[model samples]
Target: MASSDTYAAHAFHHSFDKERASGAITLTDVHVQFHNDQGQVRFPVSGTQFSLGGASDRLLFIRHPSEPDWNIYTSDLSILKHPALQNDVQIQRRVQQIKNKRRFTWGVFASVVMVLVAIPLLVVLFMDSLTGPLARHVPPEWEQKLGETAFAQYQMGQDFLKQEESDQLLDPLLQPLLQQLQDERYPFQFYISSDDAVNAFALPGGIVVINSGLILKADSADELLGVVAHEISHVTEQHSVRNIMGTAGVYLTINAMLGDMSGLLAMVANAAPYLINQSYSRGFETQADEKGLALLYRAQIEPEGLVTFFEKLREQEQKQLDKVAGEDNRESIESTLQFLSTHPATEDRIDHLQEQINELPHQNTLDLSLPFTTLQERVKRFVAKEDEEPET
Candidate 1:
């Protein structure tokens, strides 16, 4: 026990004795002195520490250092001889409760952090396998619904030829070419158009249209076969249908992202002119060239005729350029010759075909005789009669 006092400074010392019992603790004669600017005051703080025996025991004790000593037990307020000291213990307990609440808040914050980092990582790990199912999830009717819509849009821009042009100049050449290429394995149709753009194309539903200018431009039968076989490969592999489907999907997805509900409707309404630039992909072009050359070789036609056709077109381009300097007319003509587009240039393709031909054994010769000169004479006579006959 210790005690001290200072009158001028208004201070006093406190002292007490502590003892431990079976499940509680006792404090004897505790003296508490309060000092402020006004004055000093001394009091007796009385309490005996009592604990509820458990895994964790908390005990606090205080007592009065006076002759009339009092003992207080923390278990009950009535057991405390000094009620004022119990109030001090209650105030300390509230401060401790605030600290426990802050700790629980920190625990919740940590759990949220872990979830935020883990969820994306799990998704990335499984994404590859998930995409396959996602791609296949499109409805079964989507292709037909999309196909009809695309075809309608594509037909609006077509230019049909006059009936006289069809019977005379066009049908005479195409009918035989059609019969020559036909196989029981694949049935195809030939549509003649008067488009003079020097272009030819194939469509999804086995429709192959060739322009008269393209036929007149080809000097040899083998070169014409090369072009036909190329279009035939497009039909067999279904590249046109695949392209239409792919383009339509991309169009729809973009419009959907923009929140447009009528994208498909708009696409269907304008499909015909839309297909004008449906260029074959580069891989499809190469595949077609390889297959076309094979078909020519199988038909006993020399691949050199295809090469010769390209040479003639190149020569025509030079003459046209010399006549019209800085003009793009020749360039446009060259574009229709299969040399200036996604397909490999005719020269490069010829080199590859020549290499393949070298590896295969030569077949016994072929005779490809076309009667274009004789057919032209007959067509002139027929047209003259139509012109001489006046309109009814």
Candidate 2:
């Protein structure tokens, strides 16, 4: 019963209703018709405000003040490309800018994470190569300063044997070795500590300290010379300084990459303590042993003394191990010997020293039997005197 024009309008409305239900909208007579989950709705653009929502390259997003959710449209849809949008240039530009910003933000975040993960890996993989060169940059004066600081810290609250007493015992033994080494680059000063640990260590700036226990442990002056030469080699080779710089360099580089400057002062403050307590790496120990043997050869001292000292230590360690009942007890006892702990007198090391000894031509070195015996007795008397004195 309807006229054809009325029927045509009704058909168009029916089609629009279906399209709007699926989140599609078209502008007609300055009004937008769309359907939300609530069903078909229409609003006049004159009263509604437009806003851009989330969008992608292939999709356009639009929001209206009357709607709770954004209405999505295909970017290539004719309705979106309509010339009518040109009148709302501000809205279109804002939408495009926001999309670009989102993409850029995500890209930057991903790139940052990737770089953060890569920096430490690269540093660790190339650490040796980098640290060797970086260590060379530390000046000799700085090395000396570090050594002095560490030595001062080490001597705190400790009873050092009088200089006169130390020289009387050590100078006669050390002077000939020094004369042979002929290294005048550093002022090498030796000191003896009253501590009963059979240990000797070299500071960065040619400062070597030997415990009285080490003096008592040596069988001959050549044996003591071997230990002194090894310690001297550590100083001459700048091993301590190199080690400190290498470790600090790695820590600083990591902190730098992370953009953290807060802990740098603390690290520097702890440097002296770290150097004092740090054990030399096996590579460093090997180098010192090789150079020490060479120094003994140059000094015309018997390299066999070095080998003999190590054998004695091995025998002593075995004796201690034999006394222990269980494997765990043996392990624990081995860990307690500070000399072996620090020097690590492994079988391979002993074998290597013997091989070096075999290559050397046999010669009669200085007869140090009498002086070494006197020194050992003196050390025992000094230790006994300390025990008799009350703690002040």
lDDT of 2: 0.66
RMSD to the true structure for each prediction, in A, is 17.8, 11.6
* Candidate 1 local distance difference test against the native: 0.49
Q: Which pairs of residues clash in candidate 2, taking residues 3 or more apart in a chain or in different chains?
A: none
TM-score of each: 0.45, 0.59
Question: How many backbone clashes can be found in candidate 2?
Answer: 0
TM-score of 2: 0.59
Q: Give lDDT per model, in order.
A: 0.49, 0.66
Once fitted onto the true fold, the runs of candidate 1 whose alpha carbons sit more than 4 angstroms away are 1-187, 246-272, 316-341, 371-392
- Which ranges in model 2 have alpha carbons more than 4 Å from their true place? 1-133, 249-270, 323-345, 386-392
Cα lDDT tens digits for candidate 1, 292-311: 66666666666666666666
Clash counts for all predictions: 8, 0
**lDDT, candidate 2, 1-392, per-residue tens:** 21111000011123344533344465653565654444555665444443333442434444566754435343433444444444465645654575566577668888898988787778766654444444444556666777889998988876677767767877767776788765576778888788877778998767898888888888777788888888898887767755654465556856644655344333444577777777776667887888999888877777877877777778877887887746767766766654456555566688998888888888767766776787788778777774344121
Residue 371 lDDT in candidate 2: 68
